[model samples]
Every structure is written in structure tokens, then in C-alpha cells.
Target chain A: QIAVANAQELLQRMTDKCFRKCIGKPGGSLDNSEQKCIAMCMDRYMDAWNTVSRAYNSRLQRERANM
Target chain B: MDPSASGMGSVDPRLRHFIEVETQKQRFQQLVHQMTELCWEKCVDKPGPKLDSRAEACLVNCVERFIDTSRFIVKRLEQTQKSKAGFSESLSD
Candidate 1:
């Protein structure tokens, strides 16, 4: 589906941006340790994303109730 | 940012559907970017083999409070604007 491709592109961009943040400079190829770092980085990034998402969702819910 | 491009049904259905999906996708990406930047500062120290539970919790709280703050500001502004309509109107003009 077109949706999947768009999602993939966004994921790719996020990976690039976050990797750069988590990894300062590229070493010769991705060494074993670096690969592990990236994997964890990806997981943590997703965790952070979900956290913010849930937070925002709840905030919206509370605000709606107030209104 | 422009909604005019997606206005009305003049394009192919498939393309229109694609546009709708892409718009949603972009919104997700934008939020993810914002959240990443925020939680990076709050949760991340030196990159490690795995993300510790403490940092993970911080990330969740960060996101929730960020949204809460945004809502709080919006509501506060609306309330203030009611009494300061002339002030905002002058700025808008």
C-alpha cells in the first residue's frame, strides 16, 4: 500500500536522524558494539515516541473534558 | 501545510487516498521528531547496550507533560483572548 511506503520513508528518516544523535561519527563499518548500540537506540527511540504519544493523548482527553 | 492541495475530489481516488495517508504519516513523523528531541535530552545519557527502565519512564512522562503543557497554554490563551480581543486583533492586523 502507498501508506506502507510513506511510513517506511518516515521511519528511514527518523532512523537517520536518531542514529546521528546516538552515534557521533561512523566508524569503519558498523562494528559489533556499534550495531548493538543502534539496536537499543532504535528501541529507546520508539519507547520515547510512544511515551510522548500517550502523554499527548491523555492531555487531549483531559482538555476535552474541561471544555 | 497547505490543505488547498487536497481540496475537493478532482484527482484520482487512488492518488487522493495516497494524499490522505501521506498527510497522516507526516503528522506522525512530525510528532516523533518533536518527542525524540525532547526525550533525548531528558532520558538519554551515554548510549548503552540497552535502554534502562528509568530512562524509559522518563520518556513517557516527558511526552505526557509536553502535551499537557500545550493544552494548558491553548486553554489559557483562549481565556485571556476573551478579555483581550482588541489586543490580539491589533496584533493579527
Candidate 2:
């Protein structure tokens, strides 16, 4: 359940973000270039998420070790 | 009637622990989502073919500095609150 919720949260954020990045104007339809941009944006967003997660986990571990 | 034990008898200790762990994990995941959105704005100008090295470094630094900023604000607030409390007490006396 937690995993499902997490995925849903990621999906929502990704949709919002990619929409902002890819769509400059309210086009009648998602153009081919816009679709491509959204695909790339989704991948980059996941990469960014994993990078942030690793950084935070390491920071937590470092703090724990200090304590 | 002991209020603390009113509804505690039926829950298994292991189940409670599992829930606690799950809650903690969820909190971490939620923060990751927030920070990713924030740092994405700061680091990424445009989504490229891949996440470039420069953008990745920026994201890592953004996460670290963001945490530092949070800690600094918390500590500063505590200090100010403590001083405010002392000032109020002195004024009362």
C-alpha cells in the first residue's frame, strides 16, 4: 500500500512538472515534440528523485554515526 | 477505566512496530518527492537526453544545502524563543 501510494505521488508530480516543462501553449493536442519532451522529462525526474534520495540517506547515516 | 489501555489490548506489538516503520518510510519518501521538485527547478533548465553530470551535482548540493537551511532555521528559532522567554520572565519580575 505504501509503495502504491508513493508511486501515485510520483506520477502526480511528474505529470504536473512535465506539463509545465513541455507545454508552452494550450495546444489543441499534445504535439509530437511535446510528447517527446514529456518522455524525457519523466526519465530525468526519476533520476533526480533517486539522486536526492541517496543523498538524504547518506546524510542521515552520517548524522547517526556522529550521534 | 484506564484510558491508555482502552483500545491497546487487541493490537499486536509486532504489528504496531511494522506500522511505525512504514510511517517513517512514507515520511522519507514524501520529503524526497518535495525536494526533487524543488531541486529540479534549480538544477534542470531543460530535460535533456540524459541527466548530465553538472545537473546531477547541482541536485546533490541542493539537497544538502536545503537540509542545512532547515536545520539552521530550527536552531535559530529555538534560540530566539529561548531569549524571548527569558525577556518576558524578566519583565514580569
Score each candidate by Cα lDDT. 0.71, 0.93
Total backbone clashes of model 2? Answer: 0
**Colliding pairs, model 1:** A52-B63, A55-B64
Candidate 1 segments exceeding 4 Å error:
A1-13, A58-67, B1-29
lDDT of 1 by residue, B1-93 (tens): 558765644788898888788887677657766776667677776556566788877877777777668769999999999987986998889
Isolated chain A TM-score, each model: 0.73, 0.93
Q: Distance from true position, residue A43, model 2, in Å?
A: 0.8
Candidate 2 per-residue C-alpha lDDT over B1-93 given as tens digits, one digit per residue, 9 for 90 to 100: 877566656889998789789989999999999999999999998989999999999999999999999999999978987867885567669
- Give the 10-residue window scoring lowest on summed lDDT in candidate 1 chain A: A1-10
Candidates, DockQ? 0.38, 0.93
Residue A24 in candidate 1, Cα distance off native in Å: 3.2
Model 1 clashes, total count: 2
Please report the TM-score between candidate 2 and the true structure. 0.87
Give model 2's share of reference contacts. 0.98
